[model samples]
Target: MKTALIALTTATFVGTAAFAAVADLDSDGDGVVSFTEMLASYPTLTEEGFSAIDTNGDGVVDEEEMTAATEGGLIPEA
Candidate 1:
């Protein structure tokens, strides 16, 4: 029974993490995600919204930022 409880807890944690990661991608907490939606969620984003998504500020949002935006959450990951 202890083992089963542990397993259940572990699964719940993993599921929560996964959901959070995906939620990060949804800047507005909406089901859909898009560059426009991201910009709208973060009004402070500069006219060039891409730059804001580029957390590294490398002038480009590499896989990391893309993942953060689409799966890991928003660039800022707030």
Candidate 2:
């Protein structure tokens, strides 16, 4: 499953019309969402959008940023 997402890492991306939970996408249980991890939930999320959601530019999206993205109309709400 993860490999499939990785294969599409550089593919065209956009927002999906579904709600994605951080817990569900945190496949490694690392407390932060990596690009591949996010792909599972947001199959069409672009690298640029992920960068925006990451906020700190740490290559990972934390809970606070996820909330902000959804609230700010960047990502769809649950």
Candidate 3:
């Protein structure tokens, strides 16, 4: 049971790490990343680039969008 618990804890961290890029960007912990938040990590980011990452054009980037952009090489992994 102890070993299983350890494994579960590690697994959870590893999974969360997949979104570590946004984790650092979303300073408000609102579960969504905004343009200003993205700029902090990607200094060279432009409005066009941000729009591309925003995907749904909702004016914010979420975990799924962050993952896609990273996996697609649109943004660097954090």
Candidate 4:
């Protein structure tokens, strides 16, 4: 049990770090990630791919959307 817990904690930390790495690309820190910011981290991101991940049609990808996209493999893992 202890080993499992430790593994889980490590995984969580790794995932959080990856998320933060991507979030840090938000150069403007506007709480939403713009296409330019996304592209900074993912040079291969296309207009269609970004639009698909934006989901809400808000022209920016929020944390929730980014999480979903990463988990769903729509975007490369950070």
1-78 per-residue lDDT for model 1 (tens digits)? 999999999867766654554465466555434555555555555546565556676553444455555454344422
Ranking by TM-score: 3, 4, 2, 1
Candidate 1 residue pairs in clash (backbone atoms < 3 Å): 24-73, 24-74, 25-73, 68-73
lDDT of 4: 0.81
Q: Tens digits of per-residue lDDT for model 3 on 1-78?
A: 999999999866755764786788889999888988887878788889889888999999887887777666777433
Instruction: Give the runs in model 2 whose Cα sits over 4 Å from its true position.
Output: 1-20, 76-78
Instruction: Give each prediction's root-mean-square deviation over alpha carbons.
Output: 7.7, 14.2, 4.6, 3.3
Model 4 C-alpha lDDT per residue in residues 1-78, reported as the tens digit of each score = 999999999868767755685568779867678988888878888999999999999898877777778778898544
Cα TM-score per model = 0.38, 0.67, 0.71, 0.70
lDDT for 46 in candidate 2 is 86
Instruction: Output the worst ten-in-a-row residue range by lDDT, candidate 4.
Output: 14-23
Write candidate 2's Cα lDDT for 1-78 as tens digits: 998897666332212212245666789998778989888767788899888888899998777777767667776332
Could you arrange the candidates by lDDT from highest to lowest? 4, 3, 2, 1
lDDT of each: 0.55, 0.70, 0.80, 0.81
Index of the highest-lDDT prediction:
4
Which of 2 and 3 is the better model by TM-score?
Answer: 3
Native-referenced Cα lDDT, model 1: 0.55
The TM-score obtained by model 4 is 0.70
